[model samples]
Structures are given as structure tokens and as C-alpha cells.
Target: MYSDDIAIRVNNLSKCYHIYERPQDRLKQSLYPRFQQLMGRQPSTYFREFWALRDVSFEIKKGETVGIIGRNGSGKSTLLQIICGTLTPTGGTVDTRGRIAALLELGSGFNPEFTGRENVYMNGSILGLSREEMDARFDDIAAFADIGEFIDQPVKTYSSGMYVRLAFAVAVAVEPQIMVVDEALSVGDIRFQNKCLRRLDEIKASGCSILFVSHSSTMIESFCDSVVWLEQGEIRDSGRPNEVVRRYVDYMAHGVNDSGNKSVFDIGIETEQSSNGWEWIRITDQNNVRALDDYAFKRIRVKVGEEPNASRLPCEPTVIEIECEFLALKPIEFPLFAVGIFNELNEPVIHCNSNNLGTRMIPIVDGQLVTCHFKATIPGLRPGKYLLAIGMDEGLLGAHQLLCHVYDAWVFQVLSPRSGRIQGGYVQVQDATINLQIMKGDRQ
Candidate 1:
């Protein structure tokens, strides 16, 4: 049993399956164990043991949203199935504090032979809701699902998208204290996915614990309070969403151990200094190719405000200047220079371009040493490491030829402010002024 504050507690949980090399081996595995037991001999396994999960332990506190991420066959689905009580673990214990609504598989809880209306009530009953309660919520569920007349049709006739829509509708309509989702939202259309995300945010705001599984690191980092990285059925890392997701991404990209060297994108921390006290770091040596045209980025450097060595803080005044030098393989007319800053999750937080600033640029000839300069007052980004990207293109916004774009061209850090602090959000707006107005009530 778990404490009241713990929504779901899984202790030393594990699940294993028998892997047979041939079809007949499954039959052998099933009968040989019983026969050996009856013959007063030890039962022998005809199949190999595949542990989908091994000694996995974690707790989801009530009202906390936790995300699970891993590559395919890493036991992410198996772990969620066990936690949702659809699959029993081979070892360890699972405890729950409240009603759980899960959308693990498409149409998992629905009866394919039954109508969508019938399945809705059936699912509600399984979740311990009375028929009367379901009846009152039926209209709302149907509206949310937007299945139209298909609600009266058999579930077997429904498309994959329709099935998920109705299932998500029923799951959220039940007002569960805990929600378990396993990438089912990816089935629906973009509009539906956004709608479900908004509803999920509402559910989290209502004090319901959520366990979400997705391959999207940005979603996990932005949405979940904490993250768990599962690798080969074991907990590889578990902690804050940003740190764990970063490591998971690094592992995925490099396919190396976490104890390995810094990631390819992380090489910008090492800077080279000149005798004149100017330091420049390499973001990446890769060249961006577009339309069979290749432009080589020779160098890119950043200067923070007036001081090249000044430290930027959250909610502070800062001007960012980016200088890029590239070799144009072909002639380009009026090339556009752009700079982008991304967070640890690689999501762009701020972007500026020469066109946006209404700047005029000169043309580039073949084998030209193209130098681009960008100057802007950068926003008050969160206190963390930020990646800088530089891109050079030609032509209009919608129709343009990308000559070269260097991602992670440079990396910078924003320090915490000594006077104040900006916590919990990505960007903090500078200069705050509060105004209060009170009106007096009059009586007749």
C-alpha cells in the first residue's frame, strides 16, 4: 500500500515473456513444465527468457505529471501496461490510490462488437461509475469525441482515428484521479492532438496525476514535472525533465554510454582565445546544404552586450551580437542572415533575421568570403545553456534557397540574477510595473 500523497507506487516491478525460436517450441514450453513437475523432476524452460522490465522502481506523487521515454523495445509499453493493471508483472508490487483512466492501446477497453454508445457505458461501469452517472456524462463525452452519427455505429466499423477519439473522450470524461497515456494521441489528427493536450493540461490542473509516455523529448521536457529514461528494461536515468531528457537524447544520437564524452552539440563549451583577449568557440563544423548548393561556415562568434565576457541573467538587459563568416560555393543575391537560440531541449526560444529587421545586404560572388553580422537585444531567456544557430539564405521568405545553416554553431549560458529570480518558466520579460485599482461600493 502507498501513502495518500502517492498516486501510484511501483516497487521493484518487472515483467518477463517467454521467447520461442519456433512455433512448436511454444507448445513444448507449455506442456513440458507440467510434465516435468508430475515426473518428480525440475521443470525445464523450452524457450528463452526475455525480461521486458527488470527491478523498475518509481513513485508518481499525486498531482504530479511524470513522463517515460525510451526507444522501441525498451519496455516502455510493457511497463505502462503493467502499471495500468492490464499486464501482471513477473515480480514486485504495484499500488494505486485512486481510479485510473488509461489509453494505452487503441480501443483497448472498448468492445468491438458493441456500439460506441454501449462501449462508453461499459467502460464507465468498469471504472466503477454507475449507469446514472454515465448517462449524465454521455452527451459531453460524445461532444468531445465529435464522432457524430458514428457514435451509434459498431466500434468495429470505426477508423483508427475515430476509435482513439472516442476512447480519449471516455477516459477523460470519467474524471479519474490518475491518467495513463502511452503515445495514443499520436494516432489522431493534429487538431485532435492539440485538443487532447489542452484537456490533459486541465486534468493536471485539477490535481490528477498523469503518467505520459512519448518519444518527443520536447513534449516530455515542456509538459512533465519529472522524467524517467528506460534503457533495455532498466532505469537508465531518472530526475528533472531537462537533465534526463538531455542525456537520453545524447545517448540516442551518439549511441554511447552516458559516462562517455560530451555530446556532439556540447563541444561549444571549449573556447579559443586570441592575444587580443577575444574568445570564440565552434558550435559545429557541419555545413548546411540546400538545393544542391553547399555553403561552408568558416567561423561564428557571439558577443553579449557591450562586454564580450559579460554574463547574461534571466530578466535582464542584454544585447546579442553574432558574427558569421562563410564561404559561398555559388553566387547568391541579397542573402539573409539569421540567428536562433534554442534551449536544452533544442526548441527555439528566440529568432531574428536580417529581413525581419529590414536590413539591406550585398550580393555574394562565387568563392566569396561572406560575412554576416546580426545585432539585437535578446530576450530574457531562462537561466540555462542555450544553443546558437546561424543560417544564410537567398530570396523571399516563402520561396528561398538555403545556402547554409549551422545549428549549434555556438552555445552560451545565462546565469541566475543576484537581485531577483525567475523560476518555473522559460522566458522572463524585463521591467515590471504593477498597478492596483480599487473601487468603492455604494449603498442606496
Candidate 2:
């Protein structure tokens, strides 16, 4: 959780529950008697205190991909509930910057009396979407749900697949800025699961921030930007998806895992807050469309600082939308410097660094600082955590830096885009214009 680039800023966030042996003891805590405190007694009750999330704080910038990784009871669900506003934190503030949709629990927000069509509109509205928006994507949702005429049937009669299909259709169709999915895919059919993954790619493409929770380290390592490994309601490590997953996989594989809670990377959130604004980009070399095997490091920059919602990044958005005041920190680097991504294994992944791609070579006026974005398409990583590395190619010799003991910045897991004919790559050369001409030879 980044305290700086705060999408959902959790300031000292904590959730606590009071345990009681007897049901009557619970009645006392909610409605304590004067006798409980006046006797100078420690409430002489067989009750315990359990903290789901203890003093946790971090910021998520818009469009940043994040993964929440932990064992069961590590407070992953509790933390997500707080973020999704389903459960109130015992202490601290959670500020959500934009529309949010959470696949936290199956059927978390469903009305048994409502039909699939009606529920889509209802659920979309509840998730901060307007009726008009839901109406626009009505057919799209139905097609994805694949419930056929069940769209008119009451949800009370829905099979688990039908229920999830309807719920998921509505969740992703709402165009959420922050989407939190918690093992929602595990329940669906493999075909539906793959469909949801495809939709996820579209959502990310549309600049939605996401926080995902899953027992599958493969998912976290392959798809999330950075993962938070929690243990017993506290964060142990947060960084690249693959590195954290590797540690997690190793722990599970070797059965030496004793933390029974958080992940291996105890690296806390560094980096300050970042603005969220975006302009779509396609990566390329100066020559032309890029091939999959090519690694041509091309230089490009985008004129920035022209969009709204510059502050407060959503949880899983890939395109960052944030505001900037343009401080003249000549050669200004950030809290975590450049943000990049990798696969699940501990190998060198791709990254974007000002230090590596020298953009300030030409002299500038004393205080002329303008906002610009540097985007590069990172190819060749096989869907897990390649050890994340950062460097500054400052007109010098090989100075590759695996910053921090764990270099835990830029955590992203790849979700294959749904577009069937066109697959993975930076550019879209498949699109074209078709023109028909009259027959030159006057053939019949």
C-alpha cells in the first residue's frame, strides 16, 4: 500500500473483533453495564480481541495494478471489505477515489427477488453507475452472462453458475475505477472464468485500478503489478507479483511455511502519491510495428497534465490518472522511482525509469518543468514475476540496479485480452481501411 500515490488511502486502518465464549458475553460488549467498568476489573469475561487488520496504511494511485496475497485469516477479506465499504474499519479512514466493484464474495450484492436483467441495473446503480450506463451495456451483459431467457427469471432460482454469471456481468460492465476480485473466478466454469479474465483485460485497458485476492499464486504472479503478502493481520512484504509468489510457492511446496499468514516480502510501501490521468499509447521502435522478439529500446514522451481526476488512483487501473503541480525537482525522481512489471519467476522483467531512459539530456530553463509521460511496451515475460529491476542509463556503463533488497515496485499480472484475432503486442496494425474500385477490364 503506497502512502503517497493513494488511490484508496488507508490511514492507520484497522479492524478488530471481540471474541466471546458465550453468546451472552457479546450482549455485554455492545451494551456494557456500569458494573463492568466500575469494579476496576478487566471485564472478568472469557473474551479475546482479534485484529483483522492492524494499523495498515497505504495509497493506491489510479490505474495501478495491485495484488493482495495472504493465507486464509490473514485479513485479506477484511481489508477488502473495508476498501469496498461493505465493512467499516474499527479505526482509520478509507477514501475511495472513484467507482468501485468488488468480487469479494460470491453473491455479495444480489437480490433474490430480482431477475438477471433487473439486477444488472440495480447492481450497477449500487456500484455508482447510473441507469443509463447499465442500459447501454444491457445486451453486452446478457451475452456475457449466457443465461439465455433466464435473464427474466428471478435470481432465487439461479444455479451457482447462473448467479455468478449475472453478478460478474454486472460487476465488470459498470466500468469501475477500482475493481476488487476475491476468488470469484474459482466458482465459475472454466469457459466463464476465461471470459471474465478477458473482460478484466478490457477493464484494465480502460484505466481501472484493480486489487485482486486469490490463493492461486499463479494468478497473482502472472497478473498483478505488486502483491501484498499479509500474515496474521499485518503486512509482511509487498512488491513484484512473481517474487512474492515464488516465496509463497516455495513456502507451500516445502511445507516450511510457518508464518501461517502474510507473504515473504516484508517491504513496506514506499513512493508518494501520484496523479491519475491518461492518454492511450501504443509502444513501438522508430522503425515501425514491433515484432514479438524485438527489444528495440525506443524513446517516446507524451504531453501530460491535461486531464481530470489527476489525484486518487483507483486500485487496479493500468493507465494512471492523477494531477501534478509540476514541482521543479530537476531530475525529479519519485518515492519508488519508475514503475514496471514482471512474470512470476525471479527473472529480469521490463520497467520504465527516467534514470535509465535519459529524457533530460537537453538543457532546460531554470524553472520550466512540464508534465510528460514515458511509456514503453515490455515484451517477452512469460506471465509471472521476473525479478523486477530498475536502472538509470545515465550515459554511463552497465549500472543495472535491483533497487531495495527486494525491488518491490511495479507489480502487474497479465490478463490476456479478449480480442480473438488480435493477441498480445504493443501496436494494433491489424486494423485497416477497405476500398472497392470499379473493374478495370469490364469483366462480367
Candidate 3:
């Protein structure tokens, strides 16, 4: 039994569909199962079972807002449909308390032949409201939809935006205790979207539980109290919004597997000792090295505020140290040392090169090791994992020959305390200041 405070309880909820290779296979499967059963033989199957959701379970407390995030075909929509009672589950059950309303796919819960005003009444009736009650709320619904005279036109004549507006209006007008929204707000204009968000905020304030499915991490982080990440019809992770969203972003950007063991950006490096006169290696034998014949990265290390993994503040001073060595038959001059920081998306966030900074490495002999250190205050980085790439090159800007380079040599995480200001986008602008100024008009 679920506690009284729980708004929704999903227990091992699963949905499966039979996928037949051909249309005839479906009929064959249906008839063969019964025929085999009658013959006292094992049931024959002509179709494969496709599970859209498998053994998913979670609970949402009353008045809580939860966000669902996942890639395409991840069963986010299927789960929402099952929770809203529009689709039946193949296994397990979902128990929900209080009235539930959903804004699902575009034009859902709306009839094309019915006018917008008429459809509102129809949807209201489905939500357990009387015609008299709907009439009392009709003006408020129309005003919220803001479709004006278009409310008199058939839904078939409405655009996607208008359809969403009317659907959202009806869903919220019933004053549901539980609300499910699946990317419907994304179709409206920016202004209308803000208005809808404000309305959702008011609803949330009124102790309504909400299930929001959106692709934008910013939206999830901003509005959701908790988050669930789904992949391949299974729950990948579920927890606080910041933590789950960060992991989801990392998985999406770096292709991190569900097991969290394989990293797409990880490359094998060679670091074995050699008796040859010139050998390329990593500074630490423990680190894997992918070395080139002429150049190699010896080691890479990062430190934030004297701590290895405690980068709690965005404005903290961070240090990156790279040790490299080159084996040359003759003397080499003006080698360039560079280090770049990339976010989970593999996009460069910070790049620094000795040549660009007017600092050149000393002339090198046959087997000399060079160490480069970089120190800077990291601009506010969104709370997520990042990578460091290091390289050595031969000339100045625009005409440099890459001797050797290692991508994603080191991985690090930024841990910023949760705050509304730090939730969106990749970078947190530290020391940002804003001022408003006014100039007096000359004309009267």
C-alpha cells in the first residue's frame, strides 16, 4: 500500500508490443497460439515482443515536480501515456491519487470536426465535469487560450500552436491535482511559453503534482525537483535534478554506456619502457599513453583550489600540468605546448597555447623532457564532467605541424552548489555585473 502523501506510485510497470515481420505474421501468430494450445502442444509464436517499458518503478510525492529525460524511442511518451491511463500496461500497475490531466501529443484529446469551444466542453466532460460547470469555466479557458475568435473554428483549421493552446487550456482548466505535460509547451511562441510556465508555477504552488517531459536540460533543471533518465525503455538513473541531469548530459554527449564503464572519448595510450636511445612515454607509468614516434605526452594532472575533486566554486583557481618529451636525432627549436579543456559535448571551452601566449619552449636536445604548467581562474562551468586535451606542435600560428596530440587525456568534474542562477547553459559567467542607465530626452 502506498503512503497517503504519495501522489503517484508506479510498481514494476511494463509495456510490451508484438512486432511482426509482416502483416500476415500477426494473424498467423494469433491463430497458431490457439491452435497449438488446443492440440496440447507448446504455443507457437510468429512475432517478436518489443518492450517499450520494462520493470520501471518510481514514486512521486504530492506537490512534487518530476522531469523525464531521454533520447528518442526511450519510452518517455509511453510511460506518460500509461501513467495518464490512456494506455494499458502489460505488467505491474500504477496507482495515482486525485484527478489527473495530461497534455500529450499534438491534437490528442481533441476532435478535428469539433470547434475549439465545443471540444473544450467535450474534454471537460471526459475529465468528470458537468456542462454547467464547464460553462462556468468557459470564459476563463478561452481567455487563457487567447485564441480569440479562432475558438469558434473547427480544430482541423487550427495550427499546431493553436491546437496546443486549446489543449493546454482545457487540461489546466479542470484544476487537476496531477498534471502531465509532454513537450507541448515547446510548440508555443516564447511569450506564450513564458505565460504557460508562469501558470504551471502557480499550479505547482497550489500543491499540484506535475510530470514534465522535456528535451531541454535547462528547463528540467529549472523547474523539476527530481529527474529520471530513461534509455532503451529502462531507467538509467533517478535522483536529484542536478545530479541526474548532469549524468544524462554526459551520457548523451560522450556516449557513455549504461554500465558507465566504457567512455567514448577514452583512447588507449602506450607507456612501456624501452632500452632504445630515444623513447616516448607518459610521466607516470600508471597512465596509459598513446605515443607517436617523435613525440609523447608524459603526464597530465589537474588541481582545483588544492583539491583534486572538490571544485565547489566556479571562480576557483584551477591548475593543469602537462609533462611531455620529444626524441630528436638533431636539435629542435620553438616547439609549441598547448592544452585545451572540452566539455562533455567534446566542444572546446578553454584553449591555451604557449605560442599564442608569447611563451615558447626552450630548445630541446635528443632526450630532454619538458614540463608545462597552466594556471587560470575557471569561469563558472555548469555542473558536469569535462575533459582535458594536450598536444605538442612545431611552428607558430597558422603554420604549425602537430607532433603529437592526445584527446581527452584527463577527465574532471565541476561541482557547483545548486542554485537557480547556475542551472542553465554550459558556462557560468563569474563576476557578471549589470547596470541600467537613462539619458534625458532633449525634446519636450
* Per-residue lDDT of candidate 3, residues 369-414 (tens digit): 6656666665667777776667777777788776666655666677
Q: Give the CA lDDT, 0 to 100, for residue 265 in model 3.
A: 36
TM-score of each: 0.71, 0.57, 0.70
In TM-score terms, candidate 1 sits at 0.71
- Cα lDDT, all candidates: 0.81, 0.60, 0.77
lDDT of 3 at 277: 21
Q: State the local distance difference test value for candidate 1.
A: 0.81
Model 3, residue 100: what's the lDDT? Answer: 95
**Model 1 Cα lDDT, one tens digit per residue, 1-444:** 447799999899989998889999899888888989999999988788999999999999999999999999999999888888889899998888889999996767889999999999999999999999999999999999999999999999999999999999999999999999998988999999899999999999999999999988887998999988898999988888876776676457633245223453445344678665556654443322222346767676677765663434445657877776788878888788878877888677888787887887888898888667777786677788877777788886778777666655765688877766665677776667789997788865
Pairs with backbone N, CA or C atoms under 3 Å apart (clashes), candidate 3:
269-289, 269-290, 270-289, 270-290, 282-298, 283-298
After superposing candidate 2 on the true structure, give the runs of residues whose Cα lies further than 4 Å from its correct spot: 1-5, 30-32, 36-46, 256-444
Q: Distance (Å) between predicted and true CA of 349, model 2?
A: 19
lDDT of 2 by residue, 1-444 (tens): 445445677788899998888998877766565577787765555479999999887667777778887778999999999898889889988888788987878767888998877888888777666778777899999998898999999999888888888888878877788888888887888888888888888888788888888887766766778888887898876766765666665455433333323332333222333354332222221111111121112221222124332222222223432122222323323312343443445433445545456644343233444433444433322322222322222222244322211133223333433443433333233335789997678667
Off by over 4 Å in 1: 37-42, 254-275, 280-301, 309-340, 348-385, 389-444
Q: How close is candidate 3 to the true structure, as a TM-score?
A: 0.70
Who is ahead in TM-score, 2 or 3?
Answer: 3
Candidate 2 displacement at residue 278 in angstroms: 54
